[model samples]
Target chain A: MTADQTAAWAEQAIAEAAHEPGSAHPSREEQVLLRIERARRRRPKVREERITLAHGAGGKATRTLIDAVFVDAFRNPALEPLGDGAVLDVNGGRLVFTTDSYVVSPLFFPGGDIGDLAVNGTVNDLAVCGARPLYLSAGFILEEGFPVADLRRITASMAAAAAHAGVTIVTGDTKVVQRGRGDGCYVTTSGVGVLEREITLGEPMVRPGDAVIVSGPIGEHGITIMIARGELDIEADLASDTAALHDIVATLLDAVPVRMLRDATRGGVATVLNEVAQAAQVSVVIEEPAIPVRPVVTGACELLGLDPLYVACEGRFVAVVDGDHADAAVAALRGHPLGEGAAVVGVVEADPAGLVLLKTAFGGTRIVDVLVGDPLPRIC
Target chain B: MLASQIRELCEPGRQYTFMEVCGGHTHTIYKHGLEDYLPEAVTLVHGPGCPVCVIPMGRVDDAIDLARRPGVIMTSFGDMMRVPGGQGSFLDAKAAGADIRMVYSPLDALKIARMNPDRTVVFMAIGFETTAPSTAMTVLRAAAEGLSNFFVFCNHVTIIPAIKAILDSPDQRLDGFIGPGHVSTVIGCRPYEFIAREYGKPLVCAGFEPLDILQSIHMLLRQLADGRADVENQYTRVVPWDGNRTALDVISRVMEVRPFFEWRGLGFISQSALRMREAYAAYDAEVLFDVPGVRVADPKACQCGEVLKGVLKPWECKVFGTACTPETPIGTCMVSSEGACAAYYNFGRFTRSRHKETSRT
Candidate 1:
């Protein structure tokens, strides 16, 4: 079909999708949110209108908030689709499904936002499962009395991000809530795609002596998001490294029988490695020098009495695959723009299931365990 | 230079005992895995250095009571969050949405007061000289900024008084001291001279590096063999014969010596703690947050008091690995990575334990 016909057909399907879920979808409420004229006209009420945490509850109050604000703006082809789930067709006989919720304090942040986080987070989740992301479903929980301008900006970013990920937003949902009852806006997205042809995935298949690979430097996502929010006055120009990882994951999967993949989020590499070791019943030995970390993040961590090892990550992943396929996986990942700095970080061992040992450059070993407390509280 | 000295002086077979009286030193020792380098005979005993470790369970329960009061925005450093009170901790209250804030510095507590104009912000003021400067600065700054809502619950302790208390204890078996360099930098070397003269124990203010720790052990050994007791300065780079005058002056003015303070392991030591100077009552968290509860004693089987006084090793406490670890610390010696027992266990205490268990099985 021609591009125009394809666009028209997709638009029609989106309209039908939006009709059934007309009032509940986030994009619709966001469009109404962007109506600054109406918001300004009701200035006296706007002053009384402030977000409480309850707006994120997903109820009638949530609907009114999104309708009065966010849904008014950010109306787009993909977001307007309002589908139950974004249907993605892949080249192989497999399907991958993933979902995430973004409730970052500042709906927008440096390098990304709740929209960017929702899209990238969903895409990365599918990618780690060895499936290229095909399409995404975005649902927003907007606080009532939230500004229309912010809603438009966030949706626009999400739409741009979906295009970058080569995925179409086929469907979605929206809701609103009272001002004081919510903390601005929250976004949840789900993505589904097919695994590459004949590639098996999961941790149970991981064998000893297989190599582990990391996507780019660690802790940047955590440090960047922290600095962007102006929480700690860490004197460094850092931004969150939140981005889609499907492109790199696909490249690596194409060249290897990927045994397992997991994005290091919340608990950082320590948690990620520990999870892999326990799930696969294997030990992991990683070298400290091999794990890349930006100097500013390292310095900030040192100055603020924090550990770089236990820090959080929103845009990195740990991959375990066959030993013979290791070089090929590294090559494929390195070739991608997203995985330019990817490197072989560690190797699986036959002993000590559920343990992560980091060999320092000084010839010492330290256990990398899952962090118990929040690395940087209020971080995305 | 100190490392080579350690190599030359560290001979095997004779048991040597050393104690460090700073939580900072304890944390540094374990965090860097320094204990692993020491000879098997060289036992590094835990001192009553940790403020949270020694802050009696009653005080913790008291803090919890204050933390839950309405309009109270309680703030503290990350360390105090998980420390169990008689019933619960500040984190337990925080999880229940009691507005307990975990701040990096006392200044952050002051800043919280500046931001939360409507509520009373109480900084859970705990720590030694290393942490007290910031707390004092918070009080000074809050008063300067005219923030009426800001207060502090002063559980501040002094290193010298605690050192003296430990030395005076009947079970004191330490050969020498790995004198705390950070505290010495703040309070100066002169204060620790008493540890040498009065206790007749060799005292060496050591730095936090692995090499520095190894050398301190050597210094303690030489003093023991020579039957000499004196204060020495191995960390002369930072520590002076006298400490930071401005800080001492400020702390003295804002606070005064408490007659006696309750400690978890050490009980009450006269003048061991510092209290707000009456003038700063409006900013004292303990007073504003008045919650009373039972003075639950330490577990009967736990040897934490002996462990703190160097009379018993951490592993000797029956609860070292099985019931007490960093995960579920039954005593103060297990919670901090720097606690003498925690240091031994975290790095490789399990190796010995596993070996013993396998043999028994």
Candidate 2:
């Protein structure tokens, strides 16, 4: 059949399949045609009349809001990729710059508070881009009647975290809103880092057969914050895995050829995988048993009817490495304290491009699509 | 191991169809990729068990109306927040400056009511028998604490009547049943005996684990193979034979069955839903608030009713993946995470051919 005739035939077959009772399965050619049609229609746009909380979630809605609103308005070459940080060519030296804001509820949690989170989150963002995090700018939005003592404690923790990560807090700004306008305090941190490595890495660098490795057990920070809310009556002996990943990331880069890196913060590893798949135009197939998750986190997820794959992790990052050097990359990551639980979770595939599939322990495969909304609100 | 056993039990050219009457089972089936292991002759049909999916649009409109009221905080499970009504959803209401909160439990709404003494808090309670007891306990707790500002917009439903409705539907073609795991934990094995007795369909109460579902399917197939229909329990570790007596008592105390309630796709079933008891009228949102209890018809293009009844597959729906999707859902089946349509769209599409190839190998 001619190209136009084939397309017409595929559309007719799909229509017939939809109308026919019990004839749900489409032919392979028809499936391909439908997928192409879906892809053509799914160009990201902000369709919501008003911004909902989903716009703030680090998922599909957030991406759409950013792409449709922010990215479209500030269309520049450097900002197009929308990586955690922007790599700018400053004179002869390359520099990575990124900013993150923390609106975590409760202000305090099990392993770390919002103070340290503000510092580590930004440092890790720059670090994932193969940059040596150098300086940070801290900003605070405090509510009226907020205790000065609490402010002092938070700043002190941020200072300690910055020192540990070998970054200096060079500048800062503080603003106070009315009592009901703000939730105690909100912190925003922007970091600048120098690219010391000569190697280039990004989603475009990722190829088929690349190995996907996670730094550690996922969903700890998000689950810790959820339990600390004291709403669900679930008690688990767990703490947030909120440490900076610069050192572990540096070690991994030194040992092997790294294709891409992303810190699994707000939307966890699943969101990161989807981003990689879409950007690289490749499929990712991960084994369920290979993705490491704490039992407590799994229990919490099951009780709340949440997927562990989509739960956020503050200290964890997903890395795409050369398939031939996957083992060496894992060993190098394991030598560091922060990457002790690192393991090869999945591999990149050439066919069925731009999707992430999970091979379940039961030997079945299912698509792990991008998250639609904020399942766990204010979990970062 | 269970997959091979299930495959071996399948007789050549003999078809076996089983209905999993719970949304949780449907979720597990897709989540764990259980369909890959099942033989080609066996088919698992999704039933009308998702509370969020089964809720009618008119009820959602009423909840949104309650949320829009001044000085009122509408609370609901996160699953119900995005479900759209005639006007919009709780998320849309929240975006429009209505005080809508997503709480993990009904007790959290009571806590919110207590914290804000001047404001009224209304919990949009939803779910099957598994979650009704918790709402019942929360209501009793509110009564004990004398929380006058707290009220419940109870939409809790029972599982047995819905199951019976599915069985009585003329188009239902099933040989056995996979009972809901969590609901069975509360209502127990005794409630499902009616299916085996009246419908002559074998049922096995299954758990949520991959193996648990596989084992339940195996047990149901065995019962069918033996020419004996009986209700069995594969989740014996959690589900008791008679069910949780205290929870059943609590449900009876604070709530009573309504004569009929509207399901999104299944229409209204007799004594299928629960409401606040007369003694707890003061804490009932429906009694206290001005709710427009109107019925809204389902959209013409959406075939969720046939999908709910297993008469049509989710993909058979006219708007399954094109006009209706998880992002822009025109039907309830595409809104809830566990809904059959959402499950198929999110995970099941594009894997049928691959699954067949792997099974053959």
Candidate 3:
């Protein structure tokens, strides 16, 4: 039968099943069909048979894959929210833990390398959760024919990055695979931090009239990596904006009452805004000219058919604070080197909940949705 | 200023329907929300210009079949990877152990062929006249370098035939056209003269900027107000009257017009697509491989044909936002970013409600 025919048959069966009295139980065959239909609606399923690069991209496919496969099997209270990290309470002490893996190709780029990226990535993940990142663990996967000199250089950079972030590598693991089995190197880092603040920071705390501020210009890291691949012939003077944001984040927290903080890493600021809007049940309307983007980055993005709003940023973050304290937050962030280019980009609204709208320069508004597929492949 | 001028030329109690015959113009219109600046009397219709959106499913299936062959490395643009075929996409094929790579240009595909001398590198080429010159140049380079393993699965199409087909359709009520910017840079302003001479519709070749589009609309409105139907150029800074002679020469030397080719919504049009010339047969994948050139029908519920013909708005489609979306596309219209359905879904849906509110006010 055709798809339409099957759908019609299913609709008839569902209608017949619904007509039965509530107190009167249905027959065996009808019960089986009802149960199958209920299960099909309730269960989360990843429809793709095999995994693709989009599954690894921090987009819709990634969210579906994680929720259907990993979260369903490992369902727990701590893992339910599925934020950047998990906040644990141990004997009245608050702790935040997060992990990230770095599979960026070429190993090194303009401003930073994979080693520093792995350390800063996990550190920022913990820092954004209102924690003081203290300890981290590193794991390395090396190919059989990999060079020791390159490994030493990477480790040295990782050590310097950890020292700068005021964190220590307390533990590590190493494994070797066949020459072709692995990319030259892959590093995974896990971080643990203690939350000593007397205030709470989360999406639930967000409310209407909150101000949205972003630290520095966006799309530097993703664009730098894309250029470093040397695939396209276009030339631009750019570099990755990869840095540890714990100090700057602490400064903002000390200055203003921040409702939430999210590092615009994978999926960029647009994805983070969507998550915030959905979680807080509010609308986010941003002004196009207010968003800080470098001229060079904008040029590269236009040439590559990419939007700078959706490109990834490693060091930058978005913060939600009270509307009155928005100026203070930007002032506090601008005092730091990593956030010298911070500005207020948008505001939260009550109507049209769970959506992000961009007010164009031409006095028109449009929706800004989350990233759907891998436009720029594997930067972090 | 252009918006005010366009408003000054608007006729009362009459609607002017103009089609933007380029995907880039469609993207610019929605991205910058140009509709809000225009008078309600003027309407802009999307044309069948998105190359990725016009490719038939059967051709995608054929590309996938070629990728599945042993010792074959298939390469294509990144946007083409997610476009669903009859079975699956290139991304799905790659996950199933097929060596399908995404390259930014055809020269990169040729580079892969040079690096791996033992493997056959097939570049699934898809685009319109703007991109055909690069593919033709790459093919010429491969021949000059004596690279025997490189092949091109040509799917490049022309815009003139598709525009003619839209004009020939009885349901269309178009008044003017916004000629394609990039395609006009290659094929020039003369190719679009037939639209003005034969159909009495004014055509303006416009750039891909918000202001460029506004100026083009203003020009079209002026022509309509003066009762003049002529081909004009608003993007003279980029597009020449006769086009690039060197690029046109290269394209003609390497490629030839096919008898007919299948478009996703527009169907088959005679001499509408390009194929490798007999002299370059060795570099053509169609000549080297046994492709199952089977024709597949569009899905039952999809109204992309009507949408392409300008008879139905993107939002007027039955399954437009409900079942067909950028995330889960049931038709080719929702697959590409430049596609009309995707542009509407991404940026223009809210405009409908805004328009309603404005009308009520």
User: Which residue pairs clash within candidate 2?
Assistant: none
For candidate 3, list the clashing residue pairs, or say none: none
Candidate 2 structure quality by residue, lDDT tens digits, A273-339:
9889888889898998999999989888877878889888999999999999999999999999998
lDDT of 1 at A202: 62
iRMSD values, candidates in order: 26.0, 12.5, 10.9
Give the per-residue lDDT digits (tens) of candidate 1, residues B1-361: 4445554565656667788876667655655545435545776777887666777766776777787888988888767765666555565566566788777788887888888899888888887786777778778888888889998888898888788888887777778898887777788788888778877889998887666766777878888778889888888888887888888888987898999887878887888889998888778765665546347666655667888887876656544443344433556666555566665554433223222222121
Please compute and give the TM-score of the first chain of candidate 2 against the native first chain.
0.90
| Candidate 1 local Cα displacement, residue A31, angstroms | 64
True-structure lDDT of candidate 3: 0.85
| Ranked by lDDT, top first | 2, 3, 1
What C-alpha lDDT, on a 0 to 100 scale, does residue B147 get in candidate 1? 86
All candidates: DockQ:
0.03, 0.31, 0.25
**B44-87, model 2: which lDDT tens digit per residue?**
88888888889987888889889889999999888898787766
Lowest-sum lDDT 10-residue window in model 3 chain A: A1-10
Candidate 3 chain B least-lDDT 10 residues: B352-361
